[model samples]
Target: MPVLLDLRGAKSSDVAVGTSPISELQACLHSLAEPDHHLESRPWLTGIGESMSPGLGHRLTRFAPLWARRRCRLLLPLSPPLDVDMATELDRVSRLPENDFVAAAAYAVQGGSFDPRGAVTRPGEFVAACEARSFSRGELARSLIDDPGDFRRVLVRTLEDSVDAFFAKEWERIHGRLRDEVEQTRSRLRGLPLAEVLSSVSPAARPVRDGRAVRFDKLQNLTVPLGGNPVFLVPTIHGRPHLIIRGEPGFPVVLHYPVAWRGQPPSIDEVRQRLTILSDPARLSLCRHMVNEAITTSDLARRTGMTRPQVSRHLAKLRSAGLLTSERSGRYVYHRMDVHHLMGIGVELLRVIVR
Candidate 1:
């Protein structure tokens, strides 16, 4: 379903940019499914799944006795990514006067609002001793009933190990590049209006209500419509082919989108050059014809009344600008419109110009 942003009551100051390592890690774990539904290509996760089920953590019964059941119930809900993190966002959940260490995990298990600026979270307390699938939610709640801090460490140790084993080496370069992208994303947000930012968030994000409301339809059967709460746009390098959204009646909405810098939003100078390529009528014509139809370069050349080599040159320029993405099928390569990159470039250039 779609997460509806209520732009009727929103202001320019209503939206902000935030970061969360915890959320990123959660996204990584969620992507470990065998089906690979939410990610584009996760070979590493596929390898891991071949040996173990992505749900193996929830069913850690073989390792511990009663600990198995309680931990299983609790971990599954927590496995669903949170918009906040353990370091910066944990304390806010506990509602403790000084922001205690155990608060975040407890709050998550208990379910409630998280406070950075009074950000309310959806309640995950449904498993409160409620029995389902031969498991008790109360048992899960009891797992954290005694010492939340110690329980947290136990959870972290395994999570950290699992993540480090798969992503540690890749994260150095990935994290560094994502940091740069986040910085640039913030700059662009500050430079442009909120509407423009949403327009360029992702291909799946469609603006509604005259560019005031943007419908983010990333997940199926999810419907979250906000009224007066502020929104946060948190982009990540690893979050691709998926969008994470969380909002409550009284708190801010957060949109965690993908922005992995793989030649997207090319350098400022390069983007300026790329923009000029769009001015060519021939290239624009090719783009229109290829919007929903994947055609071969030779066919595009014929349709555009250009020689095969000439069409190839135009397509190359468009691809460099990140407007077109291609895939090879045996001998012939087919190309289609990169709607996300194309719209993103629009906002990027607008930011450069308006600034």
Candidate 2:
């Protein structure tokens, strides 16, 4: 009879009549299947299905989750490794004062290696590493696993910390930029009611990467498009981005950078006038509360554990003065501020106060 065999990890020709036994062949097959079995065990696959679903690049899903998959596509604008144009933009920015400061700081940490900033982040691995490193510096807890209230507090502190770190120029200019962006996000979300914000956004498109599309149906309610791409928008717990998305749960993708859609910068005088309102302690507190999204009087009372009447009075004064805006959702009203406008004012006031 002709010898027949399949080569596993180990090299083997057709087994002769007296070669390896059937048991050995069985063990080799099992060994070969082990990694695949491990891959299947990941939590992300349980929800949306597995990574081998005939789309995108091979084996990417085995590591990252569905939301992450989408985020990877979304980051095409920021992550140099994923976008060629991003790489060029980074190159041009590298010579700028902001970038030079970033390079010097990054270089100092890398044992004085004079790697070009663009080169440092050109590859996907490097870009991921940079994000990981940035998050590590802030050291936020895994919010997805934490209590919602605690998560929100942690998020807010983290944003405040990010602002402080930026003042110190910790990490680099990119880190500073990311910090500023997150702070803006927190303020933006605070000004609007969570329900209204969530309802206004709908997932318009799925990120098709490497010829594969992520499953976003589960996140239909949470999804919103900032420009053209879909983002799984989650409220900042405390004041941080806490929502997690995945094709499946455990094997999740981390989305970096949440951006707000806005027009050009507001005039300086407009900002200054707002800051004048914020100079008062009561208004400052109100401004902080309105940083991310709007809250109804009842919700604000619950959040602050204040009496509804007192909350309503405070809200009334702010609304009457145009420091905040309110909209009715059913019988209850929700409130939020103009985050970009308030922030510009707050920033300028901070500068003036410090000076």
TM-score of each: 0.51, 0.21
- Which segments of candidate 2 are over 4 A away from where they belong? 1-273, 346-355
Cα lDDT tens digits for candidate 1, 270-344 = 657877988899988999988888999999988888999999998898887778889999999999998877777
lDDT of 2 by residue, 76-193 (tens): 1221222122224333323334333333223212211225253234433333443454453112212212232453343234323323422123223234444455444445446643
Best by lDDT: 1
lDDT, model 1: 0.55
Clashes of each: 4, 23
Error of 2 at 136 (Å): 45
